[model samples]
Target: MRWPRQVMSLLVVLALLVGPPVALLTVVGPPITGWPTSGQLRAWVQQPLTEQTLTAALTIGAWLIWLMLAYTVALRVLVRLRSTSALLRRLPLPTPLQATASGMAGAAVFGITTNTAAAAPEHSPQPLAAGTTTLHDDAGPGGGESHTIADADGISVADGWIPRDVAMQVSAAASLVWLRRRRNYRPGLTPGDQPGSDLAPLPRTVASVQAALADNPAPPVAPSSYAITRLHDVLPASGIALTGEGALSVGRGLLVTTLLTTQSRPTASLIISNAALISLLGPAARRLIQRLPLTIVESLDEATHHGHPAERRQHTNGPRQAEDTPGVSGHPAVVILDEKDCDGGDLTHLADLSMGTAIIVLGRWPAGPTWHAASSGHLYDPHDLTVPKLRLCVLDHVAAADLLAVITPGEPALGATAAPVEASEPVRPNPRLPRQSTRYRSHLSAADTPRQRLHLRVLGDPQLLIDGEPLTVRRSAGLQILVYLAAVHPTGADAAQLTDAIWPGLPHHALTGRLYTALSDLRTSIRDACGLHVIDHADDRYRLNPAQLAVDLWHLNAALRHATTAITPSAEVWQAVVDAYPADFAEGRAWPWLDPIRETIRRRIIDVCAASAAAEPDPDRALSLLQAGIRIDPYNAALQERANRLLHVLNDDNTDTGIGSPYRR
Candidate 1:
């Protein structure tokens, strides 16, 4: 049933459309005496030649079958839809909570009730079960070590407090605050990773989670979501790896140079955990929510300790970043301590550190990079595949530890009491990524000689650069910012000049550091290879050492040189120009410099195509060249319109039969 996946959708549609029509056809008809009226009031029940009876019986069966089929098809279609959350959100608010709230509201509405016991949800602040963690936590692992029990039954403080059910929904909404689609990947399962099995290497927390789902004996339920809500029982493992970019061979599709390596402009990653509910909400719901201007930020500033009533009660009013952390941090921020005593009252201490905030989560960690984690509170060794750099970020995503858990998955998470990491000690750099800092993240690898010049490839729209080896970058804008400097006659373009060139409307101060980071990457890639200053700022000139680098633009310069001045044109010259054209100038970065290169190469490609078609008369080759040229200049009326109209001239000239030459086949 290798149906293009599209056919499954089509089949469902067909069943829905055809089944109802068949039901209607069976019902709408001229009746032949109408089923014989139960054999004339039970007198002629033995009669066999009754057309009306048979017809009516067939109709009834047909309608029933049609209804069943339609119902089945509709169900299948709904299940396959990308968003399905809205349909199932009809569950009633909790009965217990609803009853309690109704009772309280009734007292106010009717004015006939005695003083009520403090309403529920006013002060009943329970803790997560032992050995569990979820994103809702404001401080690091609370209870310091373990939460103390305070009989919370019948606990209340306010006259009119929110219902428990409403509170639960509000808490759940907090989880959805910084929602983003998370990519789940496991390393060993990737083709060609078997030999590395049992390495016990550390990956990012997100990667750990991905590996968990991948290696799980049970089938995965869904992709791209936060794990199950019951955090204590079934914590979805996250992996650890350094953050950056890599080219996926993805069967045959490769994005080599489109500058995708440097993540420049990032799109919003929305995670719809309840797909069914999200589907029902649709774009309209998203717009409405965006318009709401919800200020539901939970502050982490000035939050010192955990599990203290004052700390917890007053905790909601802290720094905006703290409250905002849960929304965007991409995982739960939990603080772990030894105990809830005043000394480590994870709550009070949490308050001081918070500086008047709850939680501020504004990083692009996908439930974050990984650390050593437990499956069922036991040491769970993970297979090694996640690149090492992104791991620490992963663990920090979920665990609210005093210090980050930076070890592999099986290793025990280091607690706050562990020896302090010396500020002077050099950090062990990320293994998955080369040690390149933001200082030069955006410059091009300045190759010192023609031999070191990297090759350029066009996978689709954008072309990627490979200087002896592929380069990895974290931000696309950084890559673009780097490439412009790289592509420029690298005598480094001034910061002001480059900014205006790349982003005409953007202010200098806002993008200067970011652009500087991208150049640093280019600088590092160049340093690692050809050992040259890719971009240097001196005497107000942003210059690239041409000795250290070569680009498609320069190659095109050579091709044009060979084509325009050669007394007699050769196939090699035309081929050189054709080879120089890259599908995309910058893979992921959208900047102004790319536009000129795109159009320039585009016209040059057309010139080569037309020249090749004229110089060589093979129809297949000519057609291919022309078609390639046409792709870029589809609306060009001059070349195509003139050539097609001069078809007779082209047919008659066999030696130079291009699109409209005077030559015949």
Candidate 2:
């Protein structure tokens, strides 16, 4: 390829130099009287050349050679000086000095390629040969970043470097800079651009947390000031309160994340003694910690010692810190302390330090009056553990037992962990009575045992009655969870179903983890108090083990089923069903998940009452029963219709005034 190109270059040069002169002499020279014979022309060609003609041919050849030499020199200079301009840009210099250096570089490049002024007058321009030819050379930088030339009609080549690559690189750098500036600028809400200017957009995790809190029936109160706020609206001013040992274990992580996300100030800190609490909250809670700039201290000592020095200050009278006042910045530091078997003085000292903190003390409320005073909204009391004020949670006793079984290894757990005590009573025998139906009677006397079998009453406020002693399930979620599981018992429920029923709006990832934690808390509380594993699991589904479980709701449901199908249900059976359902299903829960079951059970109760009244021998007894049924469900058209018919019959012995209507109105 190279040889061919060189041959072409030589031919082009020779044609330019020789073709013109031959053309002029042969075609345009003075015309002869007649055309010369071939012998004559050959003789003329053979004759010696004249000095003028020889000079003209030599001069033309010399110009062609000079042009070729100039082209070769220009190409070589461009190749050798490829990196010189780039190197000059990198040197450190003042702006003015750098500009001067750049100008000098340009002058030097032009000086190398152009003929000197002194040599300009030595040669004059020659008329180029006829016809157009274009040439280009790509011999420069290794990359596509190279110089190119476009020569047309044999015109002289353009001078100086036209750096295509360097210009593109500069434009790209400018575009990146503009994009970076645009990305960093954000709009603010306040004209002054203060700390809360934009009021930080609420994180999506808040929705999951909100859903988790809603699992309980108790209403959470957000302060008037926070009514319009994002995350704060879902949070209570008093923070979340957990009473039972099980509830504390389950609700701690959820509470921590809630407090962190909805903190009054962006820079609030989270201080707790339990690292396991964070682990229990699951990946979603952990992710919340990452998104918020809150710091978590595992120990109070760390909070005191490792906290920002500026946060702690000394006053002559006492140590005055911002934490002394609750809601100082409209939010308190979330502090969870484990006080089981802890020293009283240490508890008091920590309490004093945590005055402004949303303190959740996980342990039995101290024995005496002074310690009892410690059991405020912030304190977690085993005896008085009630439904958490802010959030809803649901757990069944059996499922709770399984959960407790899982977290037992982490005993005394982070949030609601209690020290396990030795069972003082001896084991007792539970006698089996003759069964009247498929399901056995709920009552069976315990012959002295270390622990009593649990009796859960979910008809009203769910209560775990052991040995005639009713245990308080302070957490609303705790009771709700038990009720939901019982409502869907025997067949059991998968995690997704339970999550939807309990914490309905939680993100899927967070829902499962929260559900497990809640379940574990239930199991732990039951086990710690009653020493029973009431809940069982198989194939990722949770159900109450009938062998080890006894729920009043179950017994009530059984009685209701038997009464509806029995050929002649005795007054005793109907009475038993009525007694079992002392209140509506999951009374006070009123959750959307509980509504359907609640209505069904209500209708069934009405059915039993209405049918019982129809079969009564005495009109007064019949009227009383019908009236009670109507009282239970005023909207049940059947009960209302039955009561109306019974009243008409009682009023007139002979006349048939009864009318049937299906609608409630």
Candidate 3:
């Protein structure tokens, strides 16, 4: 089969190139050819053209035209092959595989079919339609998963797989899409009337997502909903089932259910069977479930009684009172069940419970639409012919933990700690040079001094301030680059490192122009506001100009360094470190690269708070310090234990007196 197709493709190419020229030669190159010689040309032109002469001339003209058309066709085909080859070269694949795929693509373009069957059925969970395009993920380059995309149009090429950073970008883009849709939807607006209806497809790249966000800022939504909405689009009044035994599928289902519940207005609630929660959500269910807006019951019967309390209250108040109840029908109550938990269970009562309630089942259901999720991150909706496939967003355990940590609301700021203490390193007097003349000193100061220092704040909400006045950078990438430079100040990052950080998974060469533009914008913003060149570029590396910028993170690190090295750790130094932590580093921004740095900064500050509390002499002040640390991280076991012990001691002291203890639990 393969040999026949290959042979046919070669024959087609040969026909296009050789067939026309050969036909022209056969008609004009032989002895029977009636073409006039150069010597007879003048005499033939002078004589009136005969019918035979005209016929010969027309025949020659037709053959020439045919040859030119053949050449054009061959040129276009060659151009297509060349472009396809270039695209294949850009893919992150082994040389041999890339070459094989390139050849396959060329053959496909020429109407040569090598093999139509989907290869590696073991990796693909769902059966792909006969002519549908599928991206197969085998053990990719560097032993990671790689995707090879093949379409029904006979275009097969290796498209690179998604990495963690790209995954986060995709998630963020999905959330933005969801938010935009939600914001633009009105009571009677049709799909065409909705805002962003004519917009391009959802952005799959980091740069595109950033650009989209800049153009239309994503409206804020519940943090849990924000995370879950990334997984899939949840229909408000539809029943959907996810059928797959894979962890990714199960997790996606759970997250989608959680998202629906969180989006429920007034007070969100969920009725998930106990078995489903324990078996499907696994060991960490208890901890995570506590934070989610849901309720666990033994069975569906108990769920019925617990569901829609607000609706029940309305019915009791009066028939007319139902109209006044907010969020009664605005958000659908969600019920999630596992196949094992709902074996032979009756779901008919679900309809009787409430209108617009969404039901999500983890496994096969006898009713409603079901989607199958593959381990390769493809979600297949066999029932929907129009849109049969989608890239399913999945969060692994670590990513889920990161999202939860980010969304967990920090306690309100305890009144400011002691004023920030300057680093204890004695300020060395300026080197005593020969004293300048008064006139020279005045001239030098007037020529070189900056009006105000540029302050770069990355801790808490990222902000750029000049003399304490906030400055807004319109370009998100520009601000991100500035923050990155501040984080890695002095040493700086080269172009490659910067590009990888700012636009992860994108080609560095392709992004060079955009990177230059962002860098320029950042420089212009700083220069225009403070008349200072804050970003320094040298030896192809970019860094913040130390003389022109003051970074809060730098100050925090300085205080921490001094506090750690002191002979007797000073409480004041530790307090300075605690005071310096306004919030988590780059809080509210979910840049994937910033996660590790944010966590590191957070843990360091928590340690400092604990150290400060330990160094305090007074019990009251010690408790206060511990509380401050607790406010920073409520889930920190050490801080909670310390605070509990201190509280107990104070409670005992007060109990010994006639007065009662206000601190008693």
Candidate 4:
């Protein structure tokens, strides 16, 4: 066994066995390039025997063997390299046996490689690329404020909105289909919530306010970001609170925002969150948002649907009725909202889609850096901007409860706030007043003051004011009929007059029932009238005890008489006149058959002004009174001429005996 002899022996042995299979692989593997790929090969092995893969492979193998045989001697040398031992063993056997063995072996190797691939784990799946975010994908039911949201493309709409955010993908796809065929819908919210709407409906939202907690809101966003509005119930939670106007400033790093169901009036509030409260100070900011003809983007799909077509059309660009405003946010405030600037949903969606899911308009965004507007309709481009990450807050119910006190103000809640007492004179309690237990309470605010004060907050129409505020009343006809009684208090109107005033449209018995309800509701809504009863109610009439309540008209009459009787009136007399007339006495407020009473008060005010002009000690003071009367009744030629004549006479040192003079007239 010399080295040369060993090499020689090994080559001859290797050539005989390895040569053939190496040759077979070279011949077979290349042609299969145009055939099944590695992935396809793997799938073939998993199928039943009759599948195309098994049949195709067998046919290809036989064809290769025939071609090899056609060049038998030329191929035999190539096969010698693949498997020397097997090739050697088959070469000596019958030719049919050798060919069959070679083909079978090649087919087996191909199948083995493919089957191994089939068993391996799946190949890496590519990550999703960008530019595909959409509103249809992002918004859906239960798609409100959430712990985490995917929003690379503003409003990642693909995630179908639901209580849980798992179906986003299917939702995204479905939204595309739905959006093409339908209009987006934003629910409407009235500016002032009515007395009882949400009470009976089962809540649809998962209770929120967790979003306002520490470490609860989504991580703070970057500067100059947008924040969307969100929906919340009257749950017991109030997030961060900033009070006063200066508390909202850009320098202090706060955003100016507001919420409102009513359009012109926004509740005072500021959003402390991940959003830019963009203020339009110059042409730049204006250019971005103000492309008006005062454009409004109302969803008109309702127009293309059923129901009263006329009733559904919105006349006002924003909310026409205060009660019908989409007063969407938690603690609603006054805000200048641009509907076109925002997305499809109302205020709530505006919160969720922007910086952090919170916004406020009226209350005040804690005063931030201030800027002066050089011109009207100024706008600012946000790119040249920076601000601290707004700390978002979700106000819990406690804060809402406190704010509620301010929004709805009262000593005894300007309307129906008290329960009634027993006997009209005895003033027995009605037992329905929120917390009062005393059987009888004073009608005058405190211990028997000479005058009574009434504060009203009118919710229906912005009509007249006895004081410079809204007038209050119960929704009852009989109780309101008492207004006429008091308007003529001290010299009270007769009972037959009272019956005709209240029961003009009622059956006789209806008067009793209506009166009872009116009296009961009024006692609950008005100031206390201790030991105050309808005395002399037996024969179609009733009168309030004159001492029970201080009547405005009574006070006015007293002031008038005092002024008229005093000659050479002092400043004190003028002060009495000023104090008597607080504001325009109850302007547009009235109930059934109460027009005459209203007219009487209206006339009295005019008369009192006329008398005061004549009674003032200083000619200038008299001129001022005459001028005020003229302003109140611009069309009154007599008042206008009288005022002019008075001023002219005063300027002339009262020497003129002009016929048109206020004194002569």
Candidate 5:
């Protein structure tokens, strides 16, 4: 099947190039009998519009047009070939594999380009269909009021040309798959043993890393293991010197520092000289560094002294063989030094201190491999001409701060406390209770209600419902945007805030188009389903249109708030609160920003269930409530202990009545 398609494509291209010229020569050329000679052409021009001369003129013009068209096609083909060649050259793979991968990449690009061009006309602005209303406003970014559907289509086309990022992501995903297979095949290799084998492509942005982690959700590798940090592609794990000047070098250094410290648990014992820390990492990164597990010393001498006792002893006594000195605490000690504070002598002395330690110098080091960092985050090795230049990950102060904020743990959430429950006490039931209201009623209602209602369910799998019918969101990112907006409801979020929360670590400018496209798609989907606008944008912030949309999370929180503050907390109200929580907030989704919220909500519901169980007067009913609480969180020790105690009480009562206990130990 593949061969047939390939053959047919080749034939079509060949025919296009040759068919018109051949046809002209075979059919039209006989009458003209070849081109006119120089004298004949002058005579024909002087003759003034004879039929024969006009015929000759038309034939020449047609031939010239064909030549120009063919040249243009050839030029485009050449460009595509050159780009493909560059891509192949950059890949760090065997020649055969490189060829195969490059061919696949080329085919994919061609197919995508063809499909996009074909689909362009289909996406062009069409007349409003029956019963459909215009959804988008004419307001433009320049504050103009004359935007048109054609302008939107033009934006889509212009943005379509730069799907290079998508291709890069696809290539990186393939590399990840290969790395996984390699690891599976060679299961015996420890994380530290095969450093070179860890040559998988690294994500270019922090947002990408977060998405990958959320999708996989694996535990961090242990400190004793040699964890590899990504720098665009892969950084050599054996270690190399980084030499550059100004902000670019500093940004790369900060990126490396953050990844090494936080990407895995206890990957290495990191030591940075105080001089390097102050000069290189600015205020934001320094604040983050303070919270990380690393040591900062005044000088390289202090760094060597801070090593393990065995290493210190070895350094004081004499220079042992390289293999004799293990690293600090069985983990490799990574020492970061600045050329300003460190000289050739310091490098020599540190090398003798420990063999397992990796030394990363911030400037030139003649004795070791050195990479020059450029302002654009590309690495160049003058000494190693065989390796191609590669881009490395670089993070500025703002980006680094955002990354730290996301990874760093904060204070314990409210209601997360493990309060003890008294099993012996039986709370008396309230004498009076208030009437129960409808569970899913919207508090925020407008005078002119729309024909349909929009409901967002985040308790379990995120789902959007319109008039009780499920709506399918084609893009995962679009659904995520909606969910995030609902989570931070009425307050809303600006472009920067939204980008940071949804696509963390990426520059807002870089993803501006993507954000706009997703928003447009979301608005279109909502409008198509029920001719009503569900999102409102104002003051550079986007929020759900409160009058039309309702979230289950809002109702759940309201119930909890009432339960906590009530004087004689109604049992029915507490039960309603318990029943409202079908699952954890955004259950089964692991967006990093949603974690704290999810935990807080889960803990609050657990507390409410336990409190409700304590207030029940009947033993059987109280036991049932505790069982329900346990089902929500099996690891809650207080809930577990209370349930066990209640079961014992029930068993004792049954035994006294000479009845067999249904619940046996």
Candidate 6:
């Protein structure tokens, strides 16, 4: 009963195979003498065979062999039927009644044609006459012809099937083999089937798209010097944030970064109702379409045409295939519906049915019919473990630039181009805002005069000292650029020098956009934090305004320079210099450019300490300064000797010669 369908199929095949043979045996065997009757056959099978009854045993063995052959045929038919059923599922089929009627009519027509052909069939073969060639459809290269024609329908039929009777026979044999051996047909047992795997999250698919976009070559234009350090704070993971006028660029950059950094790139369907928004995306968006595996369609008509036209037309009156609909196919990981006119109907039909698909709605602010206190503008699913509904991200100017860079890869983002600086003009205050301008005056003085001065501390950890308060820069490139400009001083460094210092290994041309961004970020940070713009540019070189602020490193060097001209520099002056330079220049930072400056500061400190020690009258005090110099520059041989001499003067117990002097180079 458990395998009744299989059993019945097997029986039908067996009946066909065995019925004719058994009928012939029953009819013909009776005429022949010594034919085994049912009673005699049963008695022979029941008893053990003896030498005297060997003839009856042989006859009974032959009949058993025939039955075995019949059973084998039956099993082959069952296997063939199973295969047919599987194939039928993949094919488009007519209604049951229609198919049955067609099959019956075709069978009747085939029978008539076969009978008519048989009645006219007798024909003699003729040899080809000289100078004439016969073209046979099945002729071999050897000129031999095949007598039988292959079925025309057979050519159209898919292969991989055994005849019903043959398949049945094979199945029966397979079953017999399995039962008899009680072991696997192959060397090892078949492995257990694993459960079906779940589809990957849609975000993964989007990320892949984002990556492809990022890898592409950018457009011809270059990005402007626009920077915002706190982009990440405004746009967090898994939700949308609104950005105002100034933050647009930042928002756009974050969007692109988010798209690329997100773990998954699921299939996404973008529905945009506003044509203007699409146009505004420009080349970058166009490039993204070309790069990502995205399908863009506006209306239902376009969706209907996704699959075969004939299939769509045939099912126009009924429910269409899920695949025929854009997002429903599940090929896309997410659906982006940007329709200005998107309503409850669209959401109910498209987004709701989309279910597992992530739906990102754009432009339309108000909720449709689906919006409820519980729905929260997003249709919730019990299975959805991600953020609710669509994440609304605002793409600002900077964000757009980032998106452009990603989508185009090598292209400059929109609005990134810098205005051409006039060749004749040197770097000066902005003409748009004169020194007397109220806003400019306001920035200069919090009250009557500017409350904040340009305060830079680069002796230790580099920081922007604004009004005696240290302000840390979030962007490392900006900080590095600022430090380099400060180190070079009034003369500053050209674009080439800055490029070499900032990005040593990158190609010069590729650094333009990045350099612009760094400069912009530095300027922005300085303006916002210190309420001053100390950086000035001229002849393609950059420098910091010394008049506007003071730097510790600059002061240390200035003091040292003055000390050389003085008749006799006081100990206090030397001490001040030593104390002013607390740590190595650009300490805690690891940059090749910082190495020389850091070493220079170290050497200056050692010299100052050594000179101060030599001038001191007290032997113990002189030894202390010498020891300080030795500690500052352990590799300085001259400083080491000074320390040794001081130790001798002090008459220290450990003043013995060459006892592993700490200052030995």
The whole-model lDDT of each prediction reads 0.36, 0.45, 0.56, 0.35, 0.56, 0.45
Which digits, one per residue and each the tens of the lDDT, describe model 6 over residues 1-665? 55999899878876867675676567544223667789877887887576636754555666677678767776887998997897666343454554676688779979899857645546744432221212223221212221111111100001111111211222232222222221111111122321111111112112222212222112212111111121212222121212223122222222343233221332223333223225335545564434333345564334323322343335345665556543343433233344343433234343334423333343332443121111111122223336242212233332343333333322222232222222112223222322232322325544645566777788788888776776756556677777777664444567777775555433466567667766776677677765676766755567766666677767776677666567888877777777766776787764435543554456557767867776888766777777776666556556666677766644543355534434332
Candidate 1 lDDT: 0.36
TM-score of 1: 0.30
lDDT of 3 by residue, 1-665 (tens): 59999899889977867776676677655323556788678767777597766766777686768768787877998998998899776543433544676677677755633445444545635443333334433221212121223322221211212322233344553444433433332322343563433122222232323332332232322121222323323432445567664434445434533443353233334568776676555676676556455668777676666665554454343553443332244434556777665566666666455655556667776655677765434456776756535443344443343333222222111112212112223112232233333321222245676778788898889999988989878567777788877674345578887776665545666668777877777667776676777666656677666656788888788777888889888767777788888888788875535543554466567767777777788888899888887787666656777889999988888878866777754
Instruction: Please rank every candidate by TM-score, starting with the best.
Output: 5, 3, 2, 6, 1, 4
TM-score of 3: 0.44
- TM-score of each candidate structure, all chains considered together: 0.30, 0.34, 0.44, 0.27, 0.51, 0.33
Q: Tens digit of lDDT per residue, candidate 1, span 1-665? A: 45777798788779677856665666665324445566474754667458855766776676677778778878877876734464334212333544676587667756733544555577546552321222221112211111111111110111111112222222233122111100111111332332211122112221222212221213212221111111112222321211112101100000000111112211101111122112223333333223221122222222233322333434455543423433122222222111111221223333233221221112122333322322111112234444221100111112211111221112232221211111112112221323344554444443523354544332133333555565544344444555555454333457786665543333476557655655665556556655445454556556544443455555555566668779988777777777666554454432324433443345456666777776676655666566666564565444454356445444655436444543332
On residues 1-665, what C-alpha lDDT tens digit does candidate 2 reach at each position?
Answer: 59999899879867775665566556545223467689866766887486644755666675566667667767876976875765554322333544676588679968976875444546634322221122222211211111111111111111111111211222232223223322222212122442211112112122122222222112222221111112233432333334443444333333433332333333344555445344334433443334333346666465454333234333113554564433244444555544442334243344344334454454443432111112111222234446232222222222222222222211121122211111111112232322333222223345533456677676787677877688655444555567767665444568877766554433355556556666776776776677665666666666666556677766676677677779988888888887777887667643435443555466567767867887889876887787777667665555556667766766565343554423222
Clashes (backbone N, CA, C under 3 Å), per candidate, total 163, 26, 0, 105, 1, 47
Could you list the CA RMSD of all candidates, in the order they appear?
30.0, 36.3, 21.5, 35.3, 20.2, 36.8
Error of 5 at 1 (Å): 50
Off by over 4 Å in 2: 1-451, 653-665
Number of the candidate with higher TM-score, 2 or 5: 5
Runs in model 4 with CA error above 4 Å? 1-473, 489-496, 503-510, 524-540, 592-595, 611-619, 646-665
lDDT of 6: 0.45
By TM-score, the best candidate is 5
Whole-model alpha-carbon lDDT for candidate 4: 0.35
